[model samples]
Target: MKNSKRWGRRVLSALAAAAVLAAVPVGAAGNGKSKGKPPASSHRYIEVQLLGINDFHGQLNVTRKVGGREVGRADYLAAYLKQREAENKNTLLVHAGDAVGASPPVSALLQDEPTIEVLNKLGFDVGTLGNHEFDEGVAEMLRLIHGGYHPATGDFAGADFPYVSANVVDAQTGKPILPPYVIKRVNGMPIGLIGVTLTETPTIVTPSGVAGVKFIDEATAINKAVRELKKKGVQTIVVLAHNPGVSNPDGTNASGEIVDIAKNVDDEVDVIFAGHNHAYLNAVVDGKLLVQSYSYGTAFSDVDLKIDPRTKDVVAKKAEIVTTYHDGITPDPEIRALVEKYEAKVAPLVNQVVGTAAETITDEQNESGESALGNLIADAQRAAMKTDFAFMNPGGIRADIEQGEVTWGELYNVQPFNNQLVKMTLTGAQIRQLLNQQWQPTQTRMLQISGLRYTWSASRPVGEKVIDIQLPDGTPLKPDAEYTVTVNSFLADGGDGFTVLTHGTNREVGPVDLDALVTYIRQLSQPFSAQIEGRITKLQ
Candidate 1:
């Protein structure tokens, strides 16, 4: 095994620099030209292109629609990356995280090894973790990155590239779990890449996923890494952060956690690639360029930097968010074959027809914060657990059930976390408090419900938003009355900030959530459907 300390010790060999020019998308900031004025004729700058993508989520065989154009799929993403790499040999391919976990069947079924293999084939230089990377726990994550044995897929070669995360550390040791940063040389100048994931990881991931690790402040970890990199004479620094942020289509009005991180980090940090929210962001704050591509391989961030070779610092930087539209380029045949191989391997189980939807049941929430898909899944869990009510976090419902036959593969995509069902007891008042938590200061997460209804007031205070709660039979929920409640393992453990769930008693673990959903669909009459039944009401 390679020495863990040596992970970031090697300095990459130098590469020749070249000019990069690409057309900018509409509503973005960069003009497809280098940003700064030309350097003195005697001072030639080293141009390095950083190609980055975030929140991939292992959509190996999935295609998504962006602005009416069919995009995504691993092969197409590979083609786009390869084309961009050819434009500048000094380019470094990097990802901000969520490369795996919550993945579709093609990759998830094989334990996400295919995603790692694809990254290896594409030659990813450096990467960082997103919350989803901890979905199955640290051991599984390391197995996917550094290679190890898995019962389902046998031995694996793991990731070819190094993964750096300064913030995630050992719970007992209080030391970084991986190299905090990696250094690469371009034109004989050292460039540092530091990594950090959101500190809210513990709350978002299942307990076991982060069993022995603790996440610290993103900026603190970053600034400390910066000091270390500076001591080593590295001036040009980039951060690969699995944090959230968003910006207007024109790259204006940027705000999110990453924006706050950018403002606080050392000014020597030249660029940050953000992720987790899976949104488009291309803006400059605190003189540092920050960018994020919309997730699922549909887009990528192309950041160009002009590094002053003598001073070893980035003097000029600009970025453009590029959509992977399938209008012109052909998908890479080799990657397509790789995807097909995995697909065929899992076909027998995933391709089985589970049920049919009479019409599209989407996770799109209405003004009342209710969705048909969420209702369907919540009803399934409630029914499976024989509970009085069930609540599903909106984020857990990943995709829509379109009009037509629904396959196990499609269902797997909907709830990929494999969280088991938890049946517990909660008082009616406790349920009300749970509903109120949907409107927290940091986030507004509406919980999808089954077998009950509630009205919440927007004008009311955060903890008092829920005005009333009642059973489906029109019986008002009694504050002192106890009732059974059902939620997936994630929520029962207080994931997504639903801390009220943790107070529940008499918890009984049930089948995997996907199994409950599958059984519910199977036992239903053909062409069965679910809809918003006024389960949630919003008052202005």
Candidate 2:
């Protein structure tokens, strides 16, 4: 019953043609509502299906298309999970992180109430927190953690599951913001779940959103959690880490921060369910299964684990990633209804045509961290404030700008966060320092730039990276000359490990980033097309 690779999802005994394949006897309990322990057998191996979703980002609608087929709709996702569960006796559903934040208006405007409500209905047991989870700040996250109706999105009973984060520390109390870990009983086996996020969280997230919080090392946090869980007599452990590795489509060799963290974590940890970078991968690192599903509700990871009852340990494991296609699967009626109800509330605003795109500008980054969408966003920020130049973090661009009519939904997907533009002044030397600040030991902060041009050598050390700097008008930058600049408040406050941006003087604030994009699109008399235009040249 184990599906070995990251692909290979075929229902073994799917009776219904419309139902997603599951030849294996469908479990009545994958939603964490049914008892999955084997019948009193002393030496039986209990088969369990662990369904994982990561980086959902509140995609309730069926908007993203693959080969002209609608995939990743909330209803379709629900239907797939339901059908898959019917085949396995024991099952558990969990999310890695980023369930909300940078989401569409249908979910974001309601303050992500709809997102939380739908997840509750799906019956998740536990989930971790990603950087986006703190977009609205700790107070709003608390509102999501404990059940109650939110003022903006109205009624939401809150999540049925606990949000765990062992690494996120509260600055005031110097303790983990949420529960470090949670233990769930699947059948009779005590399954311990440890959650953690990248310690670089502060650099990527808005400083204000995470004002009083600090993130600790992922490996250290998980090891400590493992020691605590072992003391509770739990033998089976799963690490739901919000930090992810670079996407390797083949599921072969891959390396990133998560890879390093995985190599260093205690061997007591079993599978690592990762997120935050929206990568789809499944590979064994240090003999531990590491898996991730592509983001935006477009895909999910289906992992099957066999636990030995006598030894109380995982004996066998199989993992595969499944795309949530719409045609062959039946969309859950209840979830579809829920989506319609929430979407109706924001229809007027979300349906509006904000702009048009003659080409598809995606958020995917290059080796040097350049993206066409990032460049477009930077251009808009500079245009909005009429500054000498502007910058955008690569992580800020969420989705691609598809061809044809650009609706508010598409723009919202791109700039989901309501970050305001901050205009300021900095000298040429300070700007060079900003460029040099891009290279961290574990990260490269390639700020998408506009109204200026620069070249960098990867072979060069951190402080000596930037060379041949010039303004957009082809004027060479003078070391002592100061120029007006515009950036998001996040970067202005030294977000994303770039401190040079914070040194700028004459700070000024502008409209929200989304608003600027909407206004920029409306003003365009023709379809807008984005290009790299040699704005950034990286020499490896």
Candidate 3:
């Protein structure tokens, strides 16, 4: 009562702060001006900034203790967008797919609903479908699309953005699973976004979930959709392709799938944002701008397109790949709070101690050629299947273990996805052919081996590359004898261009991948060390 005037001023300050916090920086009209008017150039040139991210895999925070730090998470991403809009009034945010599912415990607890809500809060304009989106099944995906709330949480917050998939069609009705394309007017420019997932979706996804669905040829579906959009007077077109990209071992863009797609793509499509292989790319293929950001939201791609006013055609295009570092940027408080809340709720399961590691296990060296981690995993699979040989893809190993101790969380980090281990028998000749294909220049053919030792000449051509092969007991393998081999379902079905593996005879062994690895680790109560000694030797 004695200091009523001071109390009034404090209340006023608090109200002012609240007002400032209420407005998210997304799509704010600059200079307090109306948004409907054309720029001073009278539409002479429309500067549209296309912001894209792909293969997020539900990582809601920065990865720590890797070679380098990676900054991501929905709120930090939102801050980045707001910063961009301040520079360019005409901006559109898009995703190239793999936005939901295959996430950590926090997201997995709610079936990735929290991630979707955060994406909506960040104002994603459009998104294509990724293979992981089908992890739960197509029906659930459709439910997620048409105003369905999370099964765990009874909230009514639906997808504020649109999901597009032109190639995925119902086998019986021959109709798209989702709308083939979405046309949006951004900054007064009518733009068309077409979505196309990989045709290999049939093999990668569960057969039952996609039982009545057929994924058409990507190039064919994209061309047809672009033509339809063009007929509707949409001159600028962007294709969100979930197919893999071509990249060199150095992480630089190479001329392969992207080039092939560009050559066959419709002329009307001005830009192509690609994903699925988790490659980083920014280049011009056949006069069209092509860009792919690295996976896990470690990077963001900003593409600027200058459109001609009269013709509505793109006159110029430029792309910039920006690495998201958590250091310089402050995490948006709201998003940080949400992440903390979810983390606390899921802490018991996510942070539960599992086991300990006697030595370091890493994926860094595993992808290059042969690796200790890969060898250990392959050995584990071989032991579980009791097979003649075993192979595990380097990309399948997600994380590393420290030397001092290991935990269940660490193992999950290594094999996060719940892929199944499948055993099959193949003729010796067929196995030889499969080994030969591993030497393909464009393929990441590094194989983790069990009960084998071999040397190869990198300079030699395909079939002649495998210089030697041996059984665990130091016996030469007979070309006529059949061998039982074990591999994850992904490779057994021709993932990573291993088409030869498809010729194997299905043995029908049922062992879940991550569970098998966990069991293998538990059996070895003592700390175990993996040596990369002679698993693979490159010829000089």
Candidate 4:
């Protein structure tokens, strides 16, 4: 993109130096040069508004409760965003990432085309990729972004907004798959936006999702983009980083991957928008403004920058994390209509009653890392495959089973990845090894199991955490004995770092996870309830 007009050449005066001292975070002001001089009067200070959202997992018709207030839904989010955009003539809408994957039936059922369509209607200016965007792998991601034919969705026009990522690159060519940055002019002042996702994407996403791509260091890529942008005479810069960050409501004690990136990047970079943790953050760290709104359509980040026209540098910046409370505004009619269209199309399958829940079965784990919903899902997969045992990854369980009248859509929401269940043979020793893999150095990912029980001690080392494994018949697991095991395609392929699964033999793929869940629920007694059953034990 080209700048609308060239900025007048000027050196920073004492006033500009003062603004830099006041506006820029401590130690963040560059080496006393290239700082922009502020306009003489307050009226000359150009107010540019940047509205950003992140981790919107395509809840087109879903509403969520935030702080006891009902907030969210595509149409309501659109109304709030549009209202905020109208408050300033110089405004841009952007997203950090995860706009599509792990979505509800309304969008995921249609290949997430409706999510992109709604973002198009809202006129998003730029975006970056989150780990979820890579859930289906690179080719499909590009198909969603650049418009291509899919057997499910047919011909499609992709996102109108540009997707920029400074770090993600093709493995073979070692070149960025998308542009590193995009420059957009607001009121004739150029603002450069650089995008990058977390380098840990590979660990969280299914292995196939990140195949043939590599995510380099976020800060290194960002600094490179800053140098390139500066060569293009762009003084103002913002980063859309799909990395996690969090701070208190008062903007104190900032921490996370994004904070590190902001500190390491060039001082000329002004604002950083963060995502992936799905938390609230609006803090000034290392002389840069960092902000992230909570995930879904629940909230958004409103960042305003005061730019000096002559110098085209950000002179002042502030941000507000706004919740999309439905109380104050009417939903946008156009987006509402679009959402209804998709919802109606999916209603036939989504609304079908599969079973009833006596009470909510939540993904909330106990001290031993076992959850009711996780147990339910693992049992379902095991039943579908007729396996001796089954393991379910906690991340695969997305939502709670609300009390009464469970629907196909609800089960779909709970297991949206549609991974086919795989029955494989693993020796008892291998099962113990797989259970121990949960305590990796970076994080713990406890697997939910069915037809077996195990105890783990936090005091044990990473690879030796499992104290004992036993079958339901009270027989101690024997190392030499091979047993049938079931897991989703993601786990079978070693997703979430369960590499031991890759060693399994005699693998047979069965029904998709959602279908297995639906079938299991349908056959259950009415008003079924699942609970923690002492499958995992913690050492005191």
- What TM-score would each prediction reach against the true structure? 0.93, 0.87, 0.81, 0.91
Q: How many backbone clashes does candidate 1 have?
A: 1
User: lDDT for every model?
Assistant: 0.84, 0.77, 0.70, 0.84
lDDT score, candidate 3, position 37: 30
Candidate 1: give the clashing pairs.
Answer: 27-250
Q: Quote model 3's TM-score.
A: 0.81
Which candidate's TM-score is highest? 1
lDDT by residue for model 3 (1-540), tens? 000000111122222222223222211211122123333654468788898988776777535321234346756666666666567768888898878665666666666776777777677899998887776778767666665655576654567899989999999898998999999886677899999987766655555546678898888888889889989999999999887664332334555566688879888889989877665567777777787766666556778888887888889887665555455566667777777787787777667655667778764453236777888788889888888889887656766677866666567667766778889998777776777776655454576778777777767878778777777677877789988999887677676567888788866655878778878877876777777767677878
- What are the runs in model 2 whose C-alpha is more than 4 Å off? 1-43, 65-70, 246-251, 362-372, 538-540
Q: Which digits, one per residue and each the tens of the lDDT, describe model 4 over residues 158-197? A: 9999999989999999899999999999999999999998
Q: Which whole-number lDDT from 0 to 100 does residue 137 have in model 3?
A: 75
Model 3 deviation from native, Cα RMSD in Å: 11.5
Q: How far is 216's C-alpha from truth in model 3 (Å)?
A: 2.8
Runs in model 4 deviating more than 4 A are 1-43
